[model samples]
Target: MNWTWFHKLGSPKWFFLWSKSYALPLFFLGSVALVVGLIWGLAFTPADYLQGNSFRIIYIHVPVAILAQSCYLGLGFSGLIFLIWQMKIAPIFIQSIAPIGAVMALIALVSGAVWGKPTWGTWWVWDARLTSVLVLFLLYMGIIGLKNALDDVALANKSVAVIGAVGLINLPIIKYSVIWWNTLHQGATFTLTEKPAMAAEMWIPLLISVIGMYCLVASLVLWRMQSIILEREHRSNWVKQEVMNNGF
Candidate 1:
């Protein structure tokens, strides 16, 4: 395969065209996966021995939490791509993904609080995992704010790229928070290095949920990136022609 094709991805017009060809199918598949996973996990999965049905919240909460953290790393990687290769699409991707990531982080925090209330007898705690998650949410807000504060797109992108790169220091803290401190939050339920503690009946649905959530996130990000491309390339002839031809 010619590596030169990779450089073509830098063009907004090229990405827009490519996304148009595949977005519909990807969206359909992602939506189906999410719906099936949610139903299976919430209804079909067996209740935990200790937490009972309340543990079902993990189907929603854990996936969003994992994606929230992973999205930040993705944003930082986009920033690195922008800074190193100067790809025009890189900043747009970061911009497009930020709001979705923020919403996911917020959802994770809210769901975690709700779940914590029943299990821990409190809606809020200063535990390491919880606090780090809150900080992650704040970081998302900061990046969004920084992006909007600047009038020039390039300048805004540069500023947020710096912020995204810097904020990555929190990722490890968030991951190890439970272990590093005596937090109420439990350690990881699944790990590559160790066997799963939960039975297959419980873990299978969780795994399905995780995979579904990733697909959902990918679909959303791709859709948003296409929108960003449209907005950024609005004045360009190719975009105008493409929009006119597609009736967009």
Candidate 2:
């Protein structure tokens, strides 16, 4: 198979054009998946025998929680790639993803708290998993802050990448906190090596929600990357022509 396209991603023009073609489709598809998953989970699936209606929140909670961690993982990886290859798009991608990841982290924390009030009878706690996830949110904020604090674009990218890579040390702590210590937070509901703890009726829709959330993240990042590219490439003839053509 041809691998030439991989190197072409280093070109802003190549990425910008391709992203415009795919981003909207991904955004629309994710919206459809989310709507279908929400309806299926909230209206059709049976409530947990124990938690009752509050369990419905999992449709939103699980996917965002997963996305929160996964986004950090992506950030960390993007950091590594930037530090090594110095790819122009690498830092832009990280910059594009950080705010979205932070929002997902916030949603996950709020949703977890909401679910907890019913299940664990508390709105907040200092449990390991909870604490680690909180730190994860802060890390996202730190990356965003670092990016803005620097005056030089190269320095900003380097700072953001370093902070992102360092903060990645928290991902494992968050994932394993349930097993490492006694916490009110539940263990894995879905695992690759084993079937989900919940019935298929419940989990299938949850899985769909996860897929939709991932698509939504991709769409957001792609759109954001385009904006960053245009700003960074403003002096280029391609960007000038594209901007003129778009009347922006």
Candidate 3:
């Protein structure tokens, strides 16, 4: 196969057309998986002996927490792409992903607080894990604010890229927060190197939820990126024609 096709990825029109074909299917599959996972987790999975039904929040909390951090990494990597090759889609991807990551971080923080309230006897803590996650959320907000604060798209992209890159310093902190400090937050319950501490009944649904959340994140990012592409390319003839034909 020729490598020439890779270069064409810079074209917004190509990505727009290609994404349209798969977006609906991805969205549908993500929805089905998320629904099945949530139902199984919330209703079918046995509760933890220690935490009881409150542990069920893990299905949401864990997935969102993982996605929140991973999405920031993604934005940072996209920024690298923008800085290196100057791909037109890179900044759009960063912009599209920021809000989603912020929302995921918020969900994780809230769910963690709720879970903490009953399990730890408190709603908030200054523990390293909690503090680092909060910092990640703030970084996401700063990126979003930078994007909106600038009127020039090019300038906004550069600014946010710099901010996102700087935020990478916190990613390692979030990952090692539990290990580095004695905190209320527990170590990873799931890992590839070791068997899950939880039983199969609980682990399976949690796994499904994690996978489903990833799918949902991908679908949302792609959809949002498409919208960004349309906005940026609105003046282009092809984009105008595509939008008109699609009844947009």
Candidate 4:
């Protein structure tokens, strides 16, 4: 063990420089996968015998839904790192990611509703999974609001970290809501222990789409983190020199 690399990530300047190098490649790969997957799934793959073309929304809905929970998990993990190691980069990641997580949650909800309309015969439902997802969305909003409402930077970061840490409970509930109770929402699309129930035509593109979405989110998070790092470190000489030399 070498932990030196881990600690170096705590440095704002180091992480900013690292992210800049990787973000563009991530965005390019993600965009290509997303476009190809969406096109293949929507036009080429045979529609579900039961759901017909309506099932196409799954290409977008499932990935964002997964991202919603994953982003919060990242937030919570960052909170813990900040609380334990007092890593400066952790709180920056938290602040930079909260709004993006909220947007992901909102997209998941809206896409779910749109998918639900033709399938469930209504735009809304009080089903267990749906309600849990709604709660997850609210939790993200609450974290965002908490961060914005505080006037003190240190206090705000601590408060947001605590909230993000506590919010971990909701993720499991969101995950198991379908199985824990009778619900209109479907069960897991794919899992590690079990083969996907979907045909290869469906799940293959979906898997690609999921990978694409994850890459896209990573790229966006890196871009945002770089911006926030710049803003917070603006008074530092290194950052000033960076701005002057690079106009970034």
RMSD of each predicted structure: 1.8, 1.8, 1.8, 1.5
Task: Identify the runs in model 4 with alpha carbons over 4 angstroms from their true place.
Answer: 173-184
Ranking by lDDT: 4, 2, 3, 1
Show the colliding residue pairs in model 3. none
TM-score of each: 0.93, 0.93, 0.93, 0.95
lDDT (CA) per prediction: 0.82, 0.85, 0.84, 0.86
Residue-wise lDDT of candidate 1 within 104-197, one digit each (tens)?
A: 8999899989988988899987766667778788889999998988999889988887778766765676557644765555786678788798
Runs off by more than 4 Å, candidate 2: 173-184, 246-248
lDDT assessment of candidate 2? 0.85
The residue-level lDDT of candidate 1 at 11 comes to 84
Best-fitting candidate, measured by TM-score?
4
CA shift of 248, model 3, Å: 2.3
The deviation in Å at residue 8 for candidate 3 is 2.3
What is the lDDT, from 0 to 100, of the residue 172 in candidate 4? 74
Score residue 197 of candidate 4 by CA lDDT: 88
Off by over 4 Å in 3: 173-179
